[model samples]
Target chain A: MSTTLNPGERPTGYLPEGADINRNIAARRLRGKIWQALFFSSLVIGLLALGTLLYTIIDDSFGYIAVQTKIDPEELSDRPLAELSKEELIEILRANISAGLFRRFDRDEPFSERSKESVLQLIEERVIGREVVASFKLTESLLERERIEATVRERFPRARLEFHSWLNRDFLTRPMSSVPILAGVGNAILGSLWVIAITMILAVPIGILGGVYLEEYASDTWYYRLIETNINNLAGVPSIIYGILGLAVFVRALEPLTSGAAFGVTDSNGRTILSAGLTMALLVLPLMIINAREAIRAVPQSIRQASYGLGATKWQTVWHHVLPNALPGILTGTILSMSRAMGETAPLIVVGASTFVVFFPDSVFDKFTVIPIQIYNWTSQPGSQFRNIAAAAIIVLLVTLLLLNATAILLRNRFKRSY
Target chain B: MTVAELSAVDMAQANGRYAVELHNTHIYYGSFRAVKDVSLQIERQRITAFIGPSGCGKSTVLRAINRMNDLIPGSRLEGRILFHGKNIYDPDVDPVEVRRRIGMVFQKPNPFPKSIYDNIMFGPRINGWRGTKAQADELVERALRGAAIWDEVKDKLHQPGTALSGGQQQRLCIARALAVQPEVILMDEPCSALDPISTLKIEELMLELRRNYTIIIVTHNMQQASRVSDYTAFFLMDADRAGQLVEYGPTEQIFTSPNDKRTEDYISGRFG
Candidate 1:
C-alpha cells in the first residue's frame, strides 16, 4: 500500500512514497489502452468467425459442376433440353416415359394444371435426368474457367459441362430428387414454413400468457417458486430431450390426433407436420416464457403504480401499459426463438420429420421435412455434389433467418421510437 | 414548546369537514411495521400536507388513504381509512373503485407511454366513456386546461407524453389524474423532482385545484408546506423507527407558533 503527500498538486493518497505521480498515472493510462485494444480485438475476432462461416456456405453454393447424363438429350429430342418450350418438354415426357409413371404423375398432380416452369422441371427430372459427377468451389469456377472446361472435355467427352450454381430460382420451387444436380429445396422450404407457422402459433400465445401469469398474477408461494425454477431450468435443457418427449407423447400416444387420422387423414400416420410442430412448440416454450418475463420485468414499477393509481385493474394495467411497453423486447426474443426453431434439426428428426418427401405438406397432418433436415440428409450422402446442394440449403436457411431477424429489428426499432 | 408538553390528540372526531379520516392506522410491509398509530383528518377542498424527514412513512400514510398500498406484495393496513364515512379497507370495498374516487400523482412524473391525448383519456376510457371523437377531443382539452398545461401542449396532443420536459410531464400527470374527475388527489412529493420554477408552478396549481379536489401532499420541503397547505401534519419516527404523527394543526399555527418543540425546531431548520 502506498501513502503519499504532494505539494500544491491533487493528493492521490494511493501513490507510493517515492513514485512519480505523473508516471504512475501514465502507466495506468497505458494499461487501460492495452485493455481497450484487447476488447476491440475480441470484437474483430467474433466478426471474423461469423464472416468465415457465411463465406464457406456461400462459396459451396455456386461453382462449376461436371455433369454426366445416361443418354444424349439431342438424340432423344429435336433440340437442346434447355431450348425447348414448356409444352414441348411436357409432350416429350408424356411420349417417352412409361404409361404407369405418367399415370402416377397425373394422380399426384395434373400436368395440364402445372405451370410452364413446373412442366419443364418435370421433363428434366423424369426424362432427361442429369448426374453431377464432379464439382468445384466458387473461386476455381471463376478464375480457372478455361482450365475447368479443358479438364471436363478431357475427362468425360460425352458428359455435359457448364458453370452451375447449386442455388437458383428453381432450388426454391423444385422437389427433392435422388440426382443431386436435379435436386431442389421446394419441399423442404414448404415443410419448414408449415412447421414454423405451427410452432409460433402454439408457442407465442401460450408463452406470453404463461409469462403474464408468472409475472403479474402468481404470488410468491412455494408452488410459484417451483414452477418458476422449473421453467428457468427448462430453457437450458438440451433440445433433443424435448424431441424424445414429443415422440412419446405427440407421435405415439396421441398418434390419432397428431396424424389427423381422427380427422380422417389416412394418408399420414403419427409422423406428420403436426407432431414436429408440437415438438418445436415444446422446445421453444421455456425460451419464449423466459424472454417474455424479462421483458415484462423491465417495465418500471412506477408505471404499474401510475396505472394502479388511475384505478386500472391488474389486467387493464398489464394490457394497456406493461405489455405494450414490453412488446418490442418480447418480439425480439420471439424472433430469436423462432430462428432457433427454424434451425432445429435434432428435435424434428426424432419426432419423425421425413428426410425425403417429394411432395409439399398439404396439411398439418402431412409428412414433412424442414430445411435443416434436408441439409442433413444431403450432407450425409457420399457424393461431393450432394454437399454442394447441402451448402445451398444452408444458404436458404441463413437467408430466411436473416429476413426474420431483419423484420424483428425493424419492428423493435419502430416500437422503441414510439415508446 | 418542549417535548413534555400537552399533546392535543384529536382522534378522528371528523364529522364532515374532513374529506378523509384515518383512525389509529398502522401501515406494514410484510411483517415490518412502517408507520404506527397515525390518526389525522385531511380537510375537504383544502391542501393538507404530511411533512416529515426521510423514512418517516409520510408517503406510506398518503398511499394508504387511496389503498394504493394494496399494489405492494404482503403489505397490510391496520385500522380504518374512512372516505365519505365509509371504511375503505372493508373486504367488500374494491381498491380499484377507491382509487377511482381518489387519484394519485407520483413523485416522479409517470405519464403513460402514449400520445398526450391518450394519456389524458386513459382514465376516462377505462371508466367507460362512450363518446364521439369530437367529445373525446373536448375532454382532453378540458383536462389539459385543468392542469394548466393546455396552451403549451394543445398543438402537440398527438406527440408522445414522455417527450414533454420534466415540469410539463408532471403537469401532464396531474392532467391524467384529473381526467376521471376524482373527489380527491394524493400527491407524493410531486415537486421534489422538479426545478424551483416547476415547484412554484405545481404549488400554484395545488392552490387552484383546492376548489374541487381534496389534496393531501407528502413533502420534505417545509417552505412548500407553509406556503401551500391549509393544514399540516408533522410525522416523527418513534423508537421502532416507525413513523407516527407528533403534531397536526393549521399550517400557520404549526409553522409560526409552536405546539411541540420538535415541530418548532424542524420549522426553524435546527433539526429535521
Candidate 2:
C-alpha cells in the first residue's frame, strides 16, 4: 500500500522524529491533570459541608457554658422577712427593689399594693443571688455571703465584681421548672439510666438468639426469606409506630404487671418507667436483630466445617466456636442499637413518659422523664434561658452516646480476627 | 501388564491387609452424578493415592470413605463404603462415630480460633478420651512429632493456631487429625496449597505415617503420587459426567506401563 499524508500531517517524518508522539503525550497529560483537579475539588467541597455542619452545632450549644452573670451584693441581704411584722418586712423589700426588677411586675398592681409579690421577689433575688438556692440551709448561707460581699465592696471600690457562669450546682440538682435557672436534670438522668438498663436486658438476648437462629439453624426457605425481608423493613419503620405498639401492648395489655393495683389505676393507660423502657426496646429491636444476623452470617463456613469435622455437635460448634468469633461484630451492632434507643423521644412520649417529673424514678412502675423529653420540654418554652438549658442537655446526651459508641469500637478492634 | 497379572498383583498386595472397601459405590450431588460405579480396596499400613485432574471426583470419592459427604446438604451415596468390613452408611451407623474413627485433613488448612494445644486436644476431648493432663500433653506432642511440626511449634503451643505459617498451619492440621488415634486418615490434596519444601516434608510424614495407619490421599500432583504413594488410582471423567476409575495398581506399574491408552496419555503428561 502506498502511504499518503495530509498537508498538516507528519508527512512521513519530514521535519523531526517523535514530534507527533510528543504532542500526543502532552495532550494526554493535560487531560489527566484536569481530571485530577476536578476530583480533588469535589472531595474538598464535600468535606467543607460536613465541617460547616459540625461547626454550627458546636457554636449554638456552647453558649450554655459561656454566658457570664454578675450577682449584685445589695440584692442579696437577708431580711428576717418571714419573722418580721408583715408591714415592716414589706417596707424593707420595697426599698431594695430595683427599677429593672420592678418593671417586670403586673401593670395593674401598684408597687406599694403588691406587697406579697414584692416580698417574694426580694427573697428570691437578695436571699438567693438571682438563682434558686437548693435548700433552706443553703439559702441562709448564700444570704450571709452576699451581706459580707456588700461590706467588702463598699470598703474597696476598685475591687472587680466576681462574675461566674450560671451552669452550676443548682442547674444540676433541681428538677425541671418554668424558671430555667432553677431547673436540673436529676430526674431525667435517672430515667435514662433505667431505660438503658431495661432496654439492654430485654433486647440483647432476644436479638442475639433470633440472629443465631436465622443465620445458623433456619433453612433458606420462602418463610425465612420473608422473615429476613420483614426484619430489614422493620428497622426502617418510623419510631412513632413502635411507640403506638408499646402503648397498646406494654401500657394497656400488661398494665397490672407494671403499675401496682393499690392506686386502682385499672385503665392501664398511665405512662410508667417500665412502659417507656419497653417501648424503646421495641423501637430498636429490629436494628439489633438485623445487625446481629449480619455479624453471624459473616463467619466463615470453613470454621463450621472444621468444627463439624472434629466431631462436635451442632450446638457445641455454635456455642463454643461460632458465637465467640462473631461476638465483636454482635457487640458493635448492639452498641449502635443502644445509641439509637437512648436518643429516641417519640416512642417514650407516646408511651406516656411525663414531660414534667419532679422526682427521680423510684421504681419501674413509677412515672419518669428522660433527657430527650426534658430537652423537648425546654425547647418548647418561651425563654432564652430554657433554650440554653436544652442545648446543655443535648451536649450531655451526645457525650453519653459517644462514650458508648467508643466502647463498642474498642471491643470490636480488640477482638477482631485476622481471618 | 495384562488384566490377569494386574489382578494377581492386587490380590498379593491385599493379602491379610484391608482397611476400607468400596463396592459398586457411586456419589451424586442432587441430580448430577459425581463418582460413578467403582470398586476398590484400600490396604492397611499403605498410602493409597487418588490422582486425577480437576473435577475428576477424586476428592468426592475420598470424602465418601469416611461418610463426610453426609455433611453436604444434597449429596447422596449408593452402594457400600465399608470400614473394617462394617458399612459406614448403614442406618444404625452414626456418622459422628465414623468420623471420629476415620479423621480427615482438608485441602486448605483450617485451624480453630484456639491455642495450638487446644487445636490438637479438640478431637480427643470430643470423643471422651479420659486421661491425665500429662497423657493428653503426650498425645499432642506425639501427633505433632508424627506430622514433623513439633519443634517449630513446641514453644508456642499456647498461641493461636492461626498465627502459624502457612506450611506450619497445614502441619498443625495434620497433627490435629492424628490426635484422635484414627484407624484411617483421609487427606484431600493436603499439600496442594503448600510450597515445595512444605510439600516434601508432608510427603515424608505421610510415608512415615503409613507404617501405623492407612492413608488415602487425593492429589492433582502426579509427582506427589509417584513420590509418596505405594498404590495409585487414576480416575477420568466419562461421557455421562461421572468420574470412573481407569486404572488401579502399583504406582511404578501405572506410571511406567499403563494398560489403558487414557492412563498412558495421562502418565506421559500429554493431557490430564
Candidate 3:
C-alpha cells in the first residue's frame, strides 16, 4: 500500500493514488460486465430454446390439410352435414357405406334415434370416410395455396382442397382411428385421467403415512435407519425398473386380483387400467415419500414441543398441528411426482399400456392408453401422416400438465395465505 | 395426602398446596446424566424460579416436572416426581394427563402458526371440548384477558398469532396455556428472547398468573429471579458436567444471604 505523506510521518491505512485506483476500478467493472453479459446470454439462450420447442409443438397442432373422401361428402349429402337433419344424414350414411360398416354403427348407437351432433359425428366417422392425404403448416397453407391446389389436383383428383386445422373441436372428441385424420385424443385423455386418479388414491395416503411414521413415530433403530436410507436411494431408481417390479408383483404374483378375474371379469388379463395405474404409483412412490418427509421435517421442532406441552397426544399433535402445517409442502411434492408420473413412458409401456385401443376405459379392468404412450405410438410410426395427430396429442399432454401444476400452485398459495 | 387420596382429584378445588415434589430425581439424555439428585417442592399458587448459568440443567430439572423430558429420545429419569402426592412417572400414570394439569411456556414465544383464537382453542379442542361456540368464545376471551393481551388482539382474533409483536406473542402463548385451565404452569426462560420492557411485562404477568396457577420458571437472569420469584433454587454444574442443586430457600433470604460460595459468585457476576 502507498500513501501521499511526509517521509518521517507514519502512514495509516495507505491507499493507491487516483490513476491506479481508476485503472483497478475499471478492470473490476469490466470483469463484472463480462460476467453479467455471459449470464444474461445464458438466460436468453435457455428461453430461446423453450420458445422454439413450444413453437414447434403449436406449429404442428394447427393448420390446413387437403382431405380426400371415398364418396364425396358433398355428393352424398345435398347440404352441409351440420345443417342436415339426423334422419337425412342417416339416409345418406345408409346409401354410402357398406352394409357391415353401417350395421356396426347402428349396433353401437342406432342412427334412427341419433341426435344431430351424433349424426354429424357419424357422417365424419364413416359416411364421408375422409382421410387427410396431405397436410400443411399454417404459414405454408396461407402462402402456398396455389401449390397446395395443384398437388391435390394431381394426387387425389376428386379431393376437396379446404382449410382444416387438425386440432379443432372434433379432434378432442373422436376415438382412435387407423386413419390419421380420424384419430383423436378422447380415449387417451380418459385413460390418463383414470390412471392418474388411481395413482393418486394409492400413493398419497400411503406415502404421507409412511412419511409421518418415519419422521415422527419410528425409533432410531438400525431397522428404521435402513428403511430411511433405502427410501432415499429408491427415489433415484429408473422408472423402467419400477415397471418390471410391477409386472412381477401386480401382474404375475397377484394376477387374479389385478386382472379383474377375481371380480369375475375373465376377459381382461393382468394388463388393465388397474395394473398400469399401480405401476405408475410404484414409479412415483419413492418421490412422494421423499418430498413428504422433507416437508414434515421442515415443520419447526418448537411447534411439536408446543403441542406436546399443551397435553396433546402424539397422534393428536401430528394430526392437528403438524399435518395442517405440512400439507402445502406435501401437495407440492405430490404435484411434482404426479406430473412426472403423467409424463413417464417406459414404465407404462413395459406394464402394457395399449397403443391401438379404440374404446375409452369403462372400468379399471379395461385396457388403457395414457397420453405419453399414445404420443410415443404416433411419433414412432413409419408414415409421416401421423405427425399432425402426434403433435396435437403432445399439446394435450402439455396443457393437462399445465393445468395440474396451476391447480397445485393455487392450492399452495391458498395455504400460504392462511398460515 | 394418602396414596389413594392423591389419585383422586377435586375438580373444583384444584390439588394440594404443594403442587409437585421431586424426590432424588436424576435426569439423563442418552447415557449422560444432565441433572443429578434434585429434590424440591413447587408450591401451589406461587412462582418458583430455578436460576443458574448455561449448561447447569435448570431447564432439564424444569422439564422433569411435567415429563416433557420424555419426548427427547433416549432421555430417561430416575426416582420420581409426585403431583399432589401421586408419582407422575407411575407405570399406569399417563404423561398426557400430567401435561394437561401442568402447562408450559417455552423460552422463545412459540405460538402456533394459526389464528389467535385457534392458538388459544387448540388445547381445549384437542382435549375433546364439546362446548358451544359461545362458551368457546368466552373461554378465549377469559384466557386472553388472563394473559393481559385481550385489548390489543380483540379486534384481530382471526389473525395469525405470529403477527403480534414479540411481547404480544409471548402473552398470546401464555393465553394459550391458560385456555386449558391447567392448574400449574411451567415457564422455561420465558423472557430471554424479549426486550427489557417485554421481559418486565412477562415478569408482572407471571406474578398475576401465580394467583391462580402454580408457576415454575427457569431463568438465567439473576435479577429476574429476585424480581419475580417467591422461592429460588440455584444450581451449579458439578465436576462431571451434571447439574446439582446448590441452594434452595425463600427468594428474599437466598438473595440476601446466599449460603454457597458459587451462588454468591454467580450473583456477584464473578464467573459463570
Candidate 4:
C-alpha cells in the first residue's frame, strides 16, 4: 500500500528520504583531521622534550669547557721562578708585559681590564698551535712557511706551548683529578669492564641451568610451582635488596676467602669489585632465568616428541633439538640482562663500590668504581663543572648501551628462524 | 569365567602366527582405567587400522604397543604386550631400545628444526651408526624415497625441514622414522592433518611400507581404513570406564561384512 508523504518530508530525485550525504562526508573528514592533528601534536611534543634535554646538557657542560686549560710546558719548566727571590720573581713577571705572558695592572686601568686570564688563555692557545688563525690576503696566496713561523713566534716569545684540548691523551690515561682539566675515566672504564665480565660469567650459566631444570626436568608439582613463582617474584625485587644480601653473605659470611686485606688496605668492609659484581649478578639473575625459561617454553612440544620418538633419550631431545631452536631467544634475553647489569648502580652502591677510586682494580678483591657510580659522584658535587663531567660520562654510557643493544638486535635478526 | 574354560577355548583356536600379542591388557591413568581387557594379535608385515570415535582408546591401544604410553605421566598398563615373542614391558627390557626398534609418527607432522638431510640422519647418528658421509647420505636418500618424498625434496635437502609444506613435513617425519629401520611403525592418525592428495599419498606409502615393516595406524576417516589396511580393529567405549575392542578381522570382512552389528552401523555411518 502506497501512502502520500507530507510536503516537508518529500524525497529529492535519486536520493534516500533520510540521508544527508554532505553531512556524513563532513563528519568523516572531521575524524580524519582530528587523527592527523593528534599524531602531529604528539610528534611535536616528543621533539620539544628532546630538544630541551639536549639544550640543558650543553648549557651546563659549557662551564666545564671554560674552566679547563692546558698547562704551558715552558711555564712548568721555568727555573727562574724557582731560583729568584720573591721580589725578583714579581719584577720579572712585570717586565714580560709585551710578551703577553702576564698582565700588569696600573693605577689607571680598572680591575676588570687588568685581569688577563682570558687573553692569556687565547695567546697560549695560539702559541701552542691549538688555535688556528687564518691570514687574509687580497689575492689567493699561500704564506711562506718561514713567514708563518716568524709571525707565530712574534705573537708569544716568553712561553713555549703545545696544542691541547679539554679532551686529551691525559683524559684517557689519568684517573679522576681534583683539578677538572686532569680528570679521566680510565679507572672507571676498567672497573665497568671487569664487573660486566664477572657478572656475565656468574649469572649466565646459573640462570640457564636453573631454567633448564625448571622447564625440562622438574615435575610440575607444588614444589616446582613454588620455585617458579618465587623466581618471577624475584625478578621484580629491587636491585638494592640483592646488594644487601651480597653484603651480608659474600662480604661477611664468606669472609675467609674474600675478605682478606691483600690489596694493602686495612678496612674489613667488603667494598671489593668481586662483591659489587656478585651483587649485580644477583640483581639480574632472576631476569636472566625468567627470559631463558620463556625462550625454552616457546620451543614447540612436537619437536621434542619427534626427537623422543626417534629413540633419542630425554636429554638427547632437549640438548640437540630443543636447545638449538631456543638459542637465539636465549641469547637475546641474555644480552638484555647484561645490558641491565652494565648500567645498574644502586646495588653496587649498597655493596660499597667506592665513588672516589683512583686506581684500576688489580684483582677481583680490589676496590672499584664503575662509570655510573663515577657519574653519580660527579653530579653530587656543588660545582656545575662536575655536572658537565657527568654529562660527558652519560654520553659515553649511552653510546656503550647503544652498541650493546644494536649487537643484540643484529644477532636476533641474523639467527631468527620461522620455526 | 574359569581357567578350565579359558584353556579349553585356547586349545581349540591357536593356529595363526602373530607378530605382536596383547593379552587382557588394561591401561589406566592414575585411578581411572582407559582400556580394559583388550586382547588382539597384530600379524607381521601387515597394515592394521584402528578406527573409532573420539577418545575411544584407539590411539591409547596403538601407543601401548611400542610402550610410548610410558611417556605420559600417571599412565599405567596391566596385562601383557608381547613383541617378537617377548614381553615389551619386562623389567630387563630398556624402553629406549624398545623404542628404537618400534618408531612412531604423531598426528601432527613434527619435523625437527634442521636441514632435511639432518632430520633423516638424526636417528642414525644418535644410535651411534658410524659410517662414511657418503653412506649416510645414501641412506637418507633411500629412506626419503621409501616414504615417497625424495622427488619433491631431493633438490632442497639442505633447506630446513620445517620450511616445507604440511604434507611434505609429514612425509619427512615418516622418512625420519624409517631411517632407524624400525621393525614396527606406529602412526597415530598420521594423515589427519593433511589434504586429500596428501592423505592418499600417505595411504599408498603405508601399503608399500607393509612389505618390510608392520604398520599400525589410527584414523578417524572410515574410507582410509577400507582403502589401505589389510586388517581392521574396531574399538568402542564400554560402561566400565575403558574402551573394548568390538571386533578384529580382515579389512574386507570388517568393512563389507562385519560380524558385529555395532561395527556395521559405524561403518555405514548410521551411528558412531
Cα-based lDDT for every prediction: 0.89, 0.79, 0.87, 0.79
Q: Model 2 segments beyond 4 Å from truth?
A: A1-50, A64-72, A75-126, A129-174, A260-270, B1-16
| Candidate with maximal TM-score | 1
Deviating ranges (above 4 Å) for candidate 4: A1-64, A67-174, A259-269, B1-16, B238-242
lDDT for each residue of candidate 2 in B99-174, tens digit (9 for 90 to 100): 7778888889899888999999988887777999899899999989988899998999999999998788988988
Any runs in candidate 3 off by more than 4 Å, and if so which? Answer: A1-41, A70-129, A142-160, A417-419, B1-17, B130-134
Tens digit of lDDT per residue, candidate 4, span A1-419?
24566667756666522557777778889999999999999999999998877665544433212111243435533663344444443344454345444433333453345334433433344333232222212111133445544554676443333222333456556688764544777788889989998899999999988888888888869988999999999999988888889889877776554555655556645677787778788888999899888999999888887888888888898899778888888899998998898898888888788888787778887888888998889889866456656766776676688888888899988877776
Off by over 4 Å in 1: A1-19, A69-129, A417-419, B1-15
What lDDT tens digits, residue by residue, belong to model 3 across residues B117-177?
9999999998778889999999999999999999999999999999899899999999999
Model 2 chain B poorest ten-residue lDDT run: B1-10
User: Total backbone clashes of model 4?
Assistant: 0
TM-score of each: 0.90, 0.80, 0.89, 0.77
TM-score of chain A of 3: 0.87
lDDT of 2 by residue, A127-216 (tens): 334442121122323355565456445654434433233345566667777666668887888889898888989989889999999988
Question: Candidate 4 DockQ score?
Answer: 0.55
Where does candidate 3 clash, by residue pair? none
Model 3 residue A114 CA deviation (Å) reads 5.6
Q: For candidate 2, give the lDDT of residue A302.
A: 77
- lDDT per residue for candidate 3 within A1-419, as digits (tens), equals 25656789766886768798998899999999999999999999999999998888777777777777777666765777778777787788788778998899889887767788887777786767777777887667778888888888998897787776777677787778888877898988899889998999999988999999999999999999999999988988898999998888887888899999999997888988899889989878888888899989988889999999999999999998889889999998899889998999898888888999998889999999989998999998867668888988888889889988998898888886332
DockQ of each: 0.56, 0.46, 0.53, 0.55
